[model samples]
Target: MPNCQTESHPPATTTSPPASKAPQTTEALQAEQAPVARDWRAPSQQEIAERKKQLSPDQFKVTQQQGTEAPFRNPLWNNHAPGIYVDIVSGEPLFSSKEKFESGTGWPSFYRPLDPQRIVEKHDDSYGMDRVEVRSKSGDSHLGHLFDDGPAPTGLRYCINSASLRFIPAERLAAEGYASFAYLFPEVKQVLPQSEPTSGR
Candidate 1:
């Protein structure tokens, strides 16, 4: 979210004309902020285990064991294609190509999540350094760390593990049941490669 200064607005004067209608009620406020239906949800544990079987050892380690991959060597680090990144375990949409940026960290970096509610952050004290660990809210897969040093509009960098995410290219969104996100990359070509063009996810 963009940073903004809190501006003070003067309170309405009692001398002002009477209001034409009542202010928004509690129910109205709740309705306005209600959660919307999501296109995907967490997969079953059985499904997750099956998916794990299909993943590479490194992928499993990074995502399941909270391990970090070597910098500049991971596949998704240099991916520049237009697509949405989903949790490998649950297939929930995590980040969009639009939010991805080159952070020189040799990992997939995003300025923000595709859906903020899909991610959860925890205090990570495993390493010698202090950091906020990121994870999938539903799948509980370890993604990576978050840092405040990032470009605007949101000063946040979500450095993620490639193995923890699956890319659904704009061209293949519909085929992969992510058609709702196709609009985000309207200019992206419909033709897609059989596999992720840059690296394995």
Candidate 2:
């Protein structure tokens, strides 16, 4: 037998096969872009944001439980100035300096609100005692209890929880999305001015 050292012959044609196209993805087939993933943490940051979801746990307790903010611990008690106070929970305008009073209670006290309709007074008997409760109309945050010791005019002292308020100064009212309330005080100076005019010129 004769051994033949011969190599196998190659194919006559030496052309590469065409590449197959990639399959279309469901995402590509859809006309619209995919939606973003929802952030579950969103609700946590919205407490003090004033433009999003509900208040955080502590804020809810202080603002909705009629809980007292530690005296001298709140940011607004020492303000000693003029401004509008809104609900910290819902950001609804509630009290203005025009109705604020010095109650000597170490809290922001208001003899009356710009509008009585803004507050919803309810009989609160939670503490084994009958008391008048004050809450914002839109937010329903438990503003401190209302007392009858207020000065003349409304005579209803709304002793509010500082933790339940977001103050906006008279000058910044328009910038803080409260321009419509500008009309509440025709003379802004007369409302939150450093001092009442000695004599109007």
Candidate 3:
């Protein structure tokens, strides 16, 4: 739910009635119009079946069966790119590069999510470990676990599975229909287009 906001302009004269609501920021407006506004509900039985066929054996196992991939060897563990990570199943934006950090855990770790609402945390007591399990709200895919040991700002580590996510580089956000999130990288100055949503890999 963390978002950017522009500074407000001077207030209107008290003589005239103030507007009922404040003006929406550019980010807010862009979010409302973003292609991500499409329905991102839980996958149905048929959808799940289709996904099983579309996804790789490792991806399906980790995301659908709650299986974990080997650490350090996963695709994104050492990734240092400027981009966003989204739910592999639903394509819902989950984490940004801005929050990513090396946790020495050999997994892709983040201090927080791009939008907290897109993530669901549940008490996990599996394998004799008391932890919090992170899942994608829309896709209902088992992402990974959360731990308290982390860096500043947010003292929480989202230890996620690479199989459960798809990385979209900053420059390709607009083309990938995630233009609203382009603001996360101010250094990449590109006119983000309003593109149609894509079915994630």
Each model's TM-score? Answer: 0.74, 0.62, 0.72
TM-score of 1: 0.74
Better of 1 and 3 by TM-score: 1
**Candidate with more favorable, higher TM-score: 2 or 3:** 3
lDDT of 3 by residue, 1-201 (tens): 100011112221222122223332212333433244343345676876676679999999889988888776689977889999988887878888877877666678876777666778888876666778899887888998876565554556688989999999999887777777777777996655566889988
Candidate 2 structure lDDT = 0.58
Which structure among the candidates has the greatest TM-score? 1
Please, what are the lDDT tens digits per residue for candidate 1 over residues 37-58?
Answer: 2555568888887887887898
For model 1, which pairs clash? none
Residue 54 accuracy (lDDT) in model 3? 92
- RMSD for all candidates, in order, please: 13.3, 32.4, 14.2
**Which pairs clash in model 2?**
none
What lDDT score goes with residue 48 in model 2? Answer: 36
Cα lDDT tens digits, model 2, 42-124, are 22334534532456565676775566665544577556566678877666777777667655556667666655655787888
TM-score of model 2 vs. true structure: 0.62
- lDDT (Cα, 0-100) at 71 in candidate 2: 54
